[model samples]
Target: MPASSSRLSSYRLPAFALALLLLLGVGIASVWGVSSLRTSNEWIGHTYEVINRIEVAERAIRSTEANARAYRLTGHPEFRSQYLIATHQVDTAHEALASAIRDNPAQHARVKRMREAAQAHLVELRRLFDLQELQGAEAARQATNSTLTLRQWNEFDTAASEMRREELRLLDQRKARSDRSATLLSAIVVLGMLLSGGLMISLMVSVTRENKRARRLELEARGAAHEMALSMAQVGELSKQRHELARYSGLLQSCQTLDEIVQLSIDTIRRLVPDASGRFYLIRASQNFHDSVASFGDHLISSPDSLMPADCWALRRGQAHMVSGEEARQLSCAHLDTGTPAPGITSLCLPLSAQGTSIGLLHVSAATDAMDHGSAVDELIGQLAEQLGLAIANLQLRETLRTQSLRDPLTGLFNRRYLEESLARELQRCERRNLPLSVLMLDVDHFKRFNDTHGHAAGDALLGQVGRQIQAGVRAEDIACRYGGEEFTVVLPELDAAGALVRAEQIRRAVEIATVQHLGQQLGPVTMSIGISTFPGDGLTPEVLLQLADATLYRAKAEGRNRVLHVSYDD
Candidate 1:
């Protein structure tokens, strides 16, 4: 486990969120700027409108003055009508100026002054006109030249000038202010554009980089997952291997022969390689061939009767052999049938070897479309072969040791030690079952005299013949042991004294009829004097029963050379 190579902490904000915030801020600034620009333009437009209205008012006043001068000069009724129209135009212009400047208190005051001056000038013109009409034109001219008229006309011109000048001054100030606002708005818009463009580019690049990073992270995560799956599979394989080895080791403890060991291996391998059929081929060293001793699961190919050493690739190569389905069809082992292998079939052959000597081969088959064969599976199967080989070898060695310990080499029957041990067990069993158990103590008649007459080989042959006869005469369930030199014992279970005597007579007759041939010389015939002892009637324990039976045999030997004799319990 190395540390991860990701730096997700460095990327706090996602690209979309950053882009959203940037767009929102740009939009808000754009809106605010547009609003500001519109307000500034409105103020600038208001100044122009106010200036135009003031100019109209000034023109109207001057026009009225001209009309009044014309009336005084012409002294006609048409002139009066023109003066009245001019007066109406002047009043309308003043009202328009007033309405236009309503929002500006200072400009409104200037409009108010212009209105008063026009009113006073109109009054003066009306009075002069009245004088001219009532008196004469000369009288009107005199009245117009009056100081009140002159002062009124001067006041009207001054007020109109003042209003125009004030409006012009205010317009200049407002125009300058609006121009600044416009400039600021333009600058804001331009700067905003540049910033937003740069920011947008930056965001785009960041998002691209983020996307790349995210994709890289995803790849790393996927790789890590694949690696983890591989690691888990390897771990599971190792655990199963350990468990399998342990289980086989335990099973080997109870196996007394190579057959049991092979069966155990077959059962285990079937579970380890699921959906795969397998078989164990034990090498018959003397036969020069391999035999299918055990098989488990299913296989694409059926097991054969036997395969020669050259028939297997694993045996020939002295190593594990593997073949994919396609490869197997081209070059499969000779042990398989003489037909084209199935498609999508996988096969593995492991040579079971121990101590550098190949003893057997393990063959397994699985479908190609199934699980992929990892190295771990291969290694485990190899280990299983090794374990199977070792376990079988160990059991075979144990069997050899066991036979040496328990069997008599001369007669190939259970030795005296085994007999005593078995006798004790039978006694215990008889006590539990409340059944009668009997022992037949037998000795060859005149064995010492025969050994003295013949060679040791002849005596050994004679003893072996007697041992075989006893073995053949007893029931399969009976225990026959070579107790000592020329003495044998057979234990019979669930038999009473009468039954024991009948079996003893049978063994006695078997010995009487048996012959021994040594060095091409056929000896006449042999006989055994048998002594019978039953449980509880003779003794309870094995030692006591054997002692009493031996004594009874001494009685039979005394009575005759060859005879089975049993003592009555009620003497």
Candidate 2:
């Protein structure tokens, strides 16, 4: 019996030793799990940062393209400045992305390809600008319309997409590893707690303490895992927002008019912020007031149709103005205030500015009592404002360039170039409709002698008055052009020889009665000779018709100064 007791005691000591070893193993596992979780969190954050850098690089590339195209189209100094800035941004973004992903060979290769594509795109843009300068806008436009630039853009986009996909793949793998680590840590903690329950009375206090510590570590790890998941979700949300912004910007680039841009902006904003109501207000040409170009969503009170620039705080301060909940009732713009208080409403006003000039305003409101107005919303607003501003500015610049190219500056009439183009088009149209077209050639009588006596400035004043008189005399469908020095031409569609004679007589009488004053000195009365030619009767081609009309004008000058002549008058 004593021998049996001795053997049992020996078994008890080894059992206690085995339990202690198990506790130690659990402690080591708890520490390892905490370290693994921290490392996984860090890697997750690194992946997100790398993704952010890639997105920024992509945006920079798009900006470079847009600014380059603008500069090519208008040759505006502001567009050039913007192009330089965008190019710099592209370089900086590429450098940062490359540095961030240097450790990954595959990602590094992708980035290298992306850089090559971007460099090629920039080189092509430079070539286009040089072509514009050396050749003309038409040659540059043709080059831009070619596929070479588009191919480079596509290559860069492909490379960027690959890089992003690879990063996301890595993120998934890392997340899986983190999940396994978390699961293993929880299992180890649970096993330790179960084993500690069987320990001897003398070891109970130490085992209990160790179990408590392990449970605490488990809870902390679970909390961290939750945070990491939330962070991943946030990253995904940010990525989605960026994609939406990119799509919106691409659409804006395709808009050719202010109205199109305004409508598109309203639709995009509504889609992006479903809970928000908004309006877009554009500054008029006179800069005196803001007109509401568009509005979207349901509001408690409709926004003003027009408001003075001073009525809005965003335009006044040239920045964003935001107010939320009860604060909105006190800080809202005068244009928005309906003298009624709005509860739980958030209002944001962002001034749309481009090239250091304020072009318009964007106003939005959302019921934010149930939702927070977080940084994501702010970021979206800022991006929308910037893209909309640039688009509107570029459209306006293009319109201005087109008008200047087609019209004469001094006379406010179509130039000789426009006249030639319109004459041919009108002849074709008249033939198509089985109608007649007329061309009128006009000359200022004794314009050289008048200039010698009254000075060139006075002659300019006389020409200006005659141009206005000619324009006023022509029908809305007729085209009046400053043909050259002391000469004018008008293309009249659907006008017969008789009709053109009457119109010429009217123009002649108007110019004869018109008086000119320059530098407070009244000049002599101005008179012009008119010669008319009709299509199918005079000639079929524009050159032939113009030649016949010019010959008739010489005959008119020989006969009398202020008389109208027709090509058929001699016949």
Candidate 3:
């Protein structure tokens, strides 16, 4: 055999040995887990028995007291017998609990106290019985109502409760211990998996190199081609799953509250992978992938764009990307630090797309390279991407829906409904947060005359184009709405009278300078008469704000056709 073949065979022997070692470890761990579970179950059962016995003792005490009272009043031997039987049960219960937790210090103390109290109570009660038997029952009963007997019964009840509480405490402690052990075991298993995977990857790489040295080029080529085919298949499956995951993620993001999003994200990811971490990366249209929305890992990168390899392989080549352990070391890659590429990061990056445009890549890692076993993991990543895509799309759709609901469909500006809702919300926020809010109500200049002259389609196109201009003119925080046909409203939060006036003038200037064209015909520039009002100055309430802004808009229209008017609270 050639030198390469000899080396390859030698490497395979060690690889097989490592595989066997791991198989043995997995078997032993499974057995250990089973034993631990059995022990935990026994502890739980023992604790429950202690609690049950304590309850029985309590019931017996109550029965004994009830029987003694009945025997005193009715002079019935049957009640007396029942009382004696009940009294005997207290001792039996104490014995059961003492036998169950004799080794436990806290449990022993509770059982000791309960047993002593029960013994004392039995002695005192028997004395009372003797007195009633020797003398008259009524005379003995009257004597039995003394503080001594009462105190003894109270002590007995207190001891029983103590026993019950102690048992519960022990149960909690045992459960917590079991939970910790299980968690530790899981961590160990995950660590072991990573170790085994690294060893296997190292062996494979060594064998491949040896084969090449031996000039067994055919075998080497076949092996490389097989790996490439498998990788491609994995990528295809990932692509399909990415679509599905995006839809689910979109649904999760639609919740009105943050708590819902958190819970949904967890559940969604859990379903995607049994024990996997998910990180959501948001980026701008820049090359660096700089912006990150949220991350869920210990060693999350501070900057997204700079962290990506500048070689541009990930973006330029749209392959389901992977970097092997050896390659990582050779390249001195950041991903291989911490004795592992970030947990769950065996490495795969899928590009995010929206409307056929690439947004960013969603990167996933696994505990070990072996977890990249087949196409299953890649497909899972694809599913996650799908959910994320749909989530983002839905959010955008929701925004559009909101715009449609609040805006005039023809004009593409905030609708009357949105105007009303925004006015109310802004008013309340201003009052509670002690911030200024303002509204501008305006009407198109001679809109009816324009419609008649140019036709409704031209007028509609004009409204749509003007709405875009109005949107472009305002800050993102400002909301512009179509109050109605030929009328519009703008709500500015944290703005005063002066600020509102400046914004209003800016909007008027932008509208005057902008012109609309339909079917290659210039329709000339459109303009609007504006009215402005400020919260607590113009009006404090929603209705008052609308009324003032509307009145100012009427005045501006009356004064001329295209002018801005400011309305004060008094005006």
Candidate 4:
């Protein structure tokens, strides 16, 4: 009986030791589970941070590109400042991303590639800026429009996308790891609870508390991830908008004429804002009213063909004026109020100005129910206004310069240089079409004797009067130039010798009867000797025609001062 009691005691000690070991194992397993969950949560957070940094970098890069383009287009100091700010932001974001992804070799390599691409893009932008400063906006615009710049931008975009994709992949992997960790921890707790009740009850309580905390953290992480996705989508949309704006701005800068500007603006505005109808009004040279040079969409039928500056609130105020259905108390532009707008319509009128001078107005309207009345759309409209203003101003300046270069100041006729160019071009056309062209050389009779008798001012007055008479008698297609001094040349396209003779006689008679007044003193009647030369009959080339016509003018002067003479084909 004593031996039996001793054996039972031995079995009791072994059982107690086994129970102790099992408790220790469960405690160690719980600790390991908790640690694993914490590591997983940390990794998930890291992944989110990396993704956020990548997006920030991408946004900064786009901002840099946009502001750089703006600087090149307008050459405004403000755009340069904004560009610098955006470039700094890009550097900051790149550094942060690099730091965050240093632990991942593949991600780090991708970031490196992104940084290189970004640097290349930045260098290209710097080149454009320098070009704008040194060579002018047109030169910079040409550089910006090059395919190399676009390709570099694409490379940067590709690098950014790759980096973003890599981060997203890592996020997925980390999230999966976190899920596995959570599942394993939950399973361990359940098995421990089943193996032993009393010891595991305390462990279960602690683990349950931990599990609740972990689940709360996971929910927060998921919410943050969802929000991040939404932010990324918004960023992408904004990026696309900026890209389109930049591309269109480049195109606008390259436009050479007002007609081209209007056509391009119409197409761009329509494409960018498909839901809206709009009109572009330019202040006419008369400065009295605005002419609607272009209109788009169905709603434009209600718009006027022309409007006074006072008709537009934007023009009158020299700022943007907006009116929505909700703002019934707002005063709409006279131009718009005259038209019947759709119900619940929103309209925006932006004054187009450059260098503090108002040049035009851009009017846009849309039905509120059919479109998004957001700040983004308004911002885009504002940008369009600015771009259009600069383009139009530049075109006007170019045209003014070109006209000054080509026209004679005193007579308002084309100069010798323009005459030569036109004659050459006309000769080419005439040759191509197998048509005849005529050249007339008209000289004021006794221009030096008249000056000596009546003083130089009277001679000038006589010459001016004769030039006016000649211009008034020519057809719309005729090209007239003050050949040099008292000599004038007129090019008549599609005119044979018979037609040329009749035109020359009319010019000579017109000049003969014209009166001249200089400094309130009446001068004698002005007469000019007209000599006519025809292409294919007298000469084929402009130089030959001009020389032969001049010789015929000498013959006219020797024969009779006021009579018109044709080339003597008999010679």
Query: Candidate 1 vs candidate 4: which has greater lDDT?
Result: 4
Worst 10 residues of 3 by lDDT: 297-306
Error of 3 at 309 (Å): 13
After superposition, the stretches of candidate 4 with alpha carbons farther than 4 Å from their true spots are: 1-231, 337-340, 369-374, 569-571
lDDT of each residue in 1-571, candidate 4, tens digit only: 2475456545555555655676677688889978988898898898889889988998999999889888877889998999999988988999999999888898888888888889988888888888888999899887665687778778777877887787788778988987887788778777765665654454455556557867988887998899899888767766766777888898887888788888887776665567678888888879899888888787732558899988878888888887777776788778875534445787888999899988988888877643353347678878888989988888889889999999888788899999989999999999999999999999988888899999887877777787788889999999999988999999999999999999999998887777788888777787888888999988889999998999999998888688788887343
Q: Among these predicted structures, which one has the highest lDDT?
A: 2
Which candidate has the highest TM-score of all?
Answer: 4
Model 3 C-alpha lDDT per residue in residues 84-149, reported as the tens digit of each score = 898888778778778887888877887787778778877877887888888869877787856877
Model 1, 1-571: lDDT tens digits are: 1122234323334544565665676577678767776776777677678778877877887777787778888877787888888889988998888888788787677678778978887877778878877897788887665677677667766766776677678767867776776677677667656765675676566567668878888887997799899889878876876688678778777887766776777677656666778788877868598888877776676657678888888888898877775774456788875663566876777888788877778888777544254546666667777877787777667778988999999888889998988899988998999999999899998999899889778999998998888888888889989999999989998899999988998888888887888899999497788888999778899988898899889888888769888865332
lDDT of 4 at 394: 86
TM-scores of the candidates are 0.54, 0.54, 0.44, 0.59
Error of 2 at 69 (Å): 99
For candidate 2, give the lDDT. Answer: 0.85
How far out, in Å, is residue 382 in model 2? 2.2
Q: What TM-score does candidate 4 reach?
A: 0.59
Q: Cα-based RMSD of the predictions, in order? A: 34.7, 33.0, 20.7, 33.2
| Cand. 3 Cα-lDDT | 0.71
TM-score of 2: 0.54
